[model samples]
Target chain A: MKTYKCYCIDLDGTVYRGKEPINETVQFVHHLQQQGKEPFFVTNNASQTPDQVLSKLSGFGIEAKRSHIMTSAMAAAKYIAYHYPGKDVSMIGERGLHDALLENGVNIVSSSKEVFVMGIDREITYEKLAQACLDIRQGATFISTNSDRAFPNERGLMPGNGAFTALIQNSTGIEPIFIGKPQGHMLEMIRLEHQYEKEDMVMIGDNYDTDIMAGINFGIDTIHVNTGVTSTEEALLKSVRPTGTFETLVECI
Target chain B: MKTYKCYCIDLDGTVYRGKEPINETVQFVHHLQQQGKEPFFVTNNASQTPDQVLSKLSGFGIEAKRSHIMTSAMAAAKYIAYHYPGKDVSMIGERGLHDALLENGVNIVSSSKEVFVMGIDREITYEKLAQACLDIRQGATFISTNSDRAFPNERGLMPGNGAFTALIQNSTGIEPIFIGKPQGHMLEMIRLEHQYEKEDMVMIGDNYDTDIMAGINFGIDTIHVNTGVTSTEEALLKSVRPTGTFETLVECI
Candidate 1:
């Protein structure tokens, strides 16, 4: 059992996509655990809840504890509460945004009242757009859960909250205060969660722009997997090349 | 009937979405033709062909001659052919990129043999990514339709090719030779299409980051539509404001 201080991994395109999980990935996680290593799954996709992700993973025979998962939405929630006076107004999104708002004790609103925080909302209408427009017109501050527009899935890329934010912005002159990765808060969340010094950590993922670059931006080591959008050869040739590169996390060990 | 030498219009939020159309938008075109303006439907979405867009618009009850459509994809393809030579490449997009490549007379390949082009493919995959990486490593060049991460829509923002491009770039260190708006070819397309001796021909669209700014970059007049991404008030408030700002094209008339 090789004991490592911390282990962070991306969810989609790495561990699983939709209802399916890479069984080899599950065994690798078990292998990591058996080796006395702690594993945590981090995801940029803001649509699903940690419970949902965990359940999906469990279906693939990988048991992910509630604490074993961290999401951009939850990190965003904590960031909002820490920065704002009390989350006076939030335009809001799906369960992730709601969960964050409630956890941070921030208030979510519909009309032109308080702060208008926007995120991924599967349920949307012109009614919500009208309300958000009114809120922005009235000078309520604007915020967004993340700037990711389309999230990748088995079916392909689907619209995320960045599109909704664009919708509200199109109706109002406001741009959101973004606190997701690349702009930095998720890294801080990772730090706060594990108390691991930045020197002790290495960010690993498939996407270079979001995952590897995000780690590099935060001054952390990155290991890019040629597993997602980029091919193995391309993954090997980044401007800010990863400290380690592999076809999969399984290969990293 | 009012007569004009040239006619140019907007796309995406302006016309068909999925399989639906906004009310009265198509009717406006009929009125435009009644006025005897040479019709040209200009678009920022570089995904579809003229026939495809025309067909989509026709399904939505707005039929246009294929020649009446001006797509950024076509513009990009022409730009590439005219500028760079002897580089036949592999592309991973819909009919739009395919048509663009063929029209430009560039030899298109989907395999590793002398592959020189990689166009935007929203319907991306690991196999495509691998092929692109292989060709790239073998010195194949890259081109993209557009860099937009997502298209703002009635439903929400759908992931555009830029997200896919980033995936490629992350993997390959090969930033594309971009040919869409606000970068290389769109301005040329605008100038060539409008044929206005007066540069005062205004480019109107809902996307501020691309459309308005691209017009500005091209030294053309632009009208910011609040229906897209940048609101009217915000568009006006910017230090570099649009020539005109409207809630919708209906208001401009």
Candidate 2:
């Protein structure tokens, strides 16, 4: 197996299944750390801040630096700061998105915005969604963190930010700029920030559509594990197959 | 101009614009009443009950019988009762929907639903939406009141039931059975209840997509007035033109 300088790993399904940690993936991360390599925790989860991700990683017995975490919220903030600089942003998200936007020096506004950013907000309201539609209809640049339709929690699969974005898009007839996995913006951010070549970076995850597609879209190698949303059989059926497939990260290591 | 026994009039833009009444439409209704004809008020609005609609009409000096009001909520409840008899229904809507469901003798359940009905809910929550998605995924028949994406209000165009329905549909990949305008369910219900023939009924409204289309779909004559969302010019451009076009309902009278 070939080794890479930067291993961009997905969180929810790859590292852990909700609250339960994947021991094989944990040990793999430990092996990488022992070799003096820090893997980037790339997640389309824009609901949590880097510190929050760090805390979760620490709970799983893997010590990860806050900078090693690249959430879609962070990528969205950076994307806005880089592309729509000096533009006032109206956002519909939680603390993670807010914190990232502020940290990236993106000006946030309540209304009269030139740019609109959306993320997974558990406390989403009709008023907020309505405002986003109004802004987009009024010609604001729309951007969303991810296009995940649903995500699993204790209750089951719930509506993700993508569904909300779809609602706004359907209402306003505007397609948003998605800055999460499957689009490669998050991976691009990691590559640009760390100054790594495409060949030096690899994406590892348990999902094919988001994680593996992100790597492929970024023109890098991808390893798909069978512990998440997509089964190995389904992944193999895709025309654009992953660079490699494994039962678990233990097999990769 | 040909007169009909049933005048299926649209609300909002046809009868009143938000809290303010359209004077020409108000006088037109009075003319119909003077001729001993009580027009049926048909609206895609599932938020208000028939009594609430009656109050609004009375406020405009038009005393309307409660039976003469047919909201999308009423049609949705009736449709559910007729099609899925004895099925336990779960719904996400306002007081109007709740009232109509109970009035129609449809069994309403909090969970373990056989059918799920969606309406425009101002106090929408993630949990409610999540449950709706889960129910649909669990094989519950999904039904929505209307497909009006946005409606004009005091604040501006607010997200309608269609937008919320689109969110759930996107999350679940299940298209809902819409019981509102352009489907003709509401008009069909009015016809069935009043036993009026198709030629004896006419849909009168200002919107081309909802009012005129509903009449066209129900195989009845339609009068498009230049008072609301779609102007007469826009309505004329449609291949399926209304039976008659008027500057106001006064012209029809």
Candidate 3:
């Protein structure tokens, strides 16, 4: 098997499922760290800050570097900063997205018709949604973090950011630019920051749609593990197959 | 012009546009009432009660009978009462829907796996939406009051009940049964309640998609007025034309 310089791994369903970590993936990460290689943790969860994510990973017995964390919120903020700098942005999101925008030096306004970004707002309201529609109607550049329709919770699968995005899109007849997996924005951010060639980096994840597709879209090798959304058999059935598919990351070791 | 026994008039675009009443439409209603025909006011607005709609009409100097008002909320409540009797309904909506459900003797529960109904909720919260998704995922029959993507307010067009319905539908992958204009539920309820023949009824409105489509779907006569969403030229271009296309209700009067 070919060794990659940069291993971009997914968090949920790859490293850990809810609070429980996949032991094989954790062992695989440990092995990579022992070899002096720091793998990047890529996630579509834009609700939690890098520190929160690091803490969650620590609880799973996997010590992940803070700088190596690449959340969709961080990517969305960086994307706005690089693309539409100095523009006041109206947003409907939580702390992670707010902190990321501030960290990226993006101006956060109460309401803006210039640029609008959305993340998973657990504290969402109709007024916020109405304001978003008004802004979009006034020709705001609509942007969303990810497009996961339903995310699993303690109770069951709950509505995700994509569902809210769909609402806005349906109302305004305007599509938004999603800066998450399967779009290559996050991967591109990691590549641009670390100056790693596409060939030298590989995406390892359990989901075929977001994780593997993100790698494929970014022109990198993708390894699919059957610990999450998509099974190895399902991954193999896709027309554009991942570089490798395994029962678990244990096979990779 | 062939006179209809039952003239089902739309509210927002036909009778009035926002707070201002269309003088011609108001005069047309007077003409109908003078001829001893009590025209029914059909509205897809699920937020306002019948009394509120009546008060609005009364303010415009059009003496509307309380019994002659048919709202989407009332129709939804009636539909639930008739079809899913004794089943608990989980809902995400406002006071109008709440009152209607109670009036129709339909039990509204906080959480239900049997049925779920949604309307335009201005006080929308993420938990409400999340709960709706969970209920739907748990095999609840999803229902919505209307399918208006956006509605005009002081601040341009705001997201409507349809937009919220789209969110839940996207999240749970369950299509909701929309009981509003363009669906014929309101028209059907009027027919059932008044015992009016389809030929004796005429749906008059400015919108071709909702009002005219509802009439056509219900197998009744429809009049297209060039006063709202659909223009006379646009209405003429549709494959299925209305029974009567006029500049305004004054033409029929």
Q: Which candidate number maximizes lDDT? A: 3
Per-residue accuracy of model 3 over A1-253 as CA lDDT, tens digit each:
7899999999999998888889999999999999999999999999999999999999988898898999999999999999999999999999999999999999999899899999999999889999999999998899999999999979999999999999999999999999999889999999999999999999999889999999999999999999999988899999999999888887887
- TM-score per model over all chains: 0.52, 0.97, 0.99
Clashing pairs in 3: none
Cα lDDT tens digits, model 1, B99-176, are 877888977767644444444454555456556655665576567777776555454444456655654565455667
Candidate 2 residue B101 Cα shift, in angstroms, is 1.3
Model 2 spans with C-alpha error above 4 angstroms = none
- The second chain of candidate 3 has a TM-score of 0.99
- Give the higher-DockQ candidate: 1 or 2: 2
**Clash pairs, model 1 backbone:** A89-A115, A90-A117, A91-A117, A112-A135, A170-B229, A234-B171, B89-B116, B89-B117
CAPRI quality level assigned to candidate 1 from its DockQ score: incorrect
Poorest 10 consecutive residues by lDDT, candidate 1 chain A: A152-161
Q: What ranges in model 1 sit over 4 Å off? A: A1-4, A170-173, B1-253
Q: Quote model 2's TM-score.
A: 0.97
> What's the DockQ for every one of the candidates?
0.04, 0.73, 0.91
Instruction: Name the candidate, 2 or 3, with the larger TM-score value.
Output: 3
